[model samples]
Target: MNTNDSKLREQIAYFGRSMFERGLTAGSSGNISVRLDDGWLMTPTNCCLGNLDPADISRLTRSGVLVSGKAPSKEFFLHEAFLDRRPTDRAVVHLHSTYATAVSCLPDVDPRNVLPPLTPYSIMRFGKVALTPYHRPGDKRLGDEISIVAAEHRAVLLANHGPIVAAKDLESAVYAAEELEETAKLFLLLQGQRPRLLTPEQVAELERVFGEKEDDRAKTCC
Candidate 1:
């Protein structure tokens, strides 16, 4: 194995543990993936994220065939949908995070854009968070729905499920997922009291400045 692949394995485990310990996800309820030159590295199925072993991370071929380690997560196709549609994206994070899943369960959110313009970072990281139609967990239909919106959105909330985020790298995908959950919490917190949002022009300016470079967004946004 190359040095980069080894590091990516450790990175996945590190973030998986962090997410699990912090309640971003629970049990074996979340998945993560990083695109490689030949294929991808993904968290194994039915494993607690908090207890991931770097060596046990699944390595799959470009065609999604398992090449090493354990079996990939059942939600493999969900990440596949984004990686297939967004050629430039190198990582994908899917989490059954509490607040985001709670928001997904809500009936009144906009189908086209589940998240309102509640925070500048949300608008900056996710231009518009699309809401995919509900499908049972690991259902290929869920991935299919994601494929339809992947062209226009880098992030999506699975109806009655949770959120999935894609980015140029694993760190960004993970951070975006965290940001999504925080934004969801803020959304729910302000449900009764109408909160003012960024104007269209302000959102446009953010899109123009921080949108073009996903990798540089964090460095430049501050």
Candidate 2:
């Protein structure tokens, strides 16, 4: 394999282990993908993120054709939809984060503002976390729902499912995904405690100064 493909494979393996170790995902429950110099590299269907083999990663053409390796994850439509809707997206990570999924189960959670402005890290890494409605795993309906919110959100929590995060690269995508879980964990900790949340003005200012450049964070590049 070419050096580029090898490196991308290593990245998938590395991030896969990190995600699995961090409890962001369990079993074979998460998927990841990154834009490549030629097209893209994605984790194979049913592959455990913690044990992915570089030679086993699914390769897709820029036009979405399956070029080599095993079949791509059935939920690939979700990734493709993000890239199609957001020209700047370079990587996609979908995970069944515990706290985020728990919050999604709340009947009153606002889809447009899933996470409160609890910390500057959340504001800078994720402008707004959209709460997408429930869809069966591998269902394309979820992709459609994400399309509607992609215009404004870099990360979204799938109701009764998980969170989907996008970034300029694999590391960034994973970082944002972790940030989502951590912030969600914080939200749960403050539940009913009415912990003071960042005001609209503060959130706005943080977004203005740090949001635009968040993709440049050391961990996020493709």
Instruction: Report the lDDT tens digits of candidate 2 across residue range 100-214.
Output: 8898788887889878789878877766899888888878898899999987898988889888988888887888898889899999998879888889999888767766776
Candidate 1 matches the true fold with a TM-score of 0.97
Q: What is candidate 1's lDDT per residue for 157-220, written digit by digit as tens?
A: 9999999999999988988999999999999999889799989999998888887766688786
Residue 152 in candidate 2, Cα distance off native in Å: 0.5
Query: Which regions of candidate 2 fall more than 4 Å away from where they truly are?
Result: 219-222
TM-score, one value per model? 0.97, 0.94
Local distance difference test, per candidate? 0.91, 0.85
Q: Give the worst 10-residue stretch by lDDT in candidate 2.
A: 213-222
**lDDT at 155 for candidate 2?**
93
CA error at residue 55 for candidate 1, angstroms: 0.3
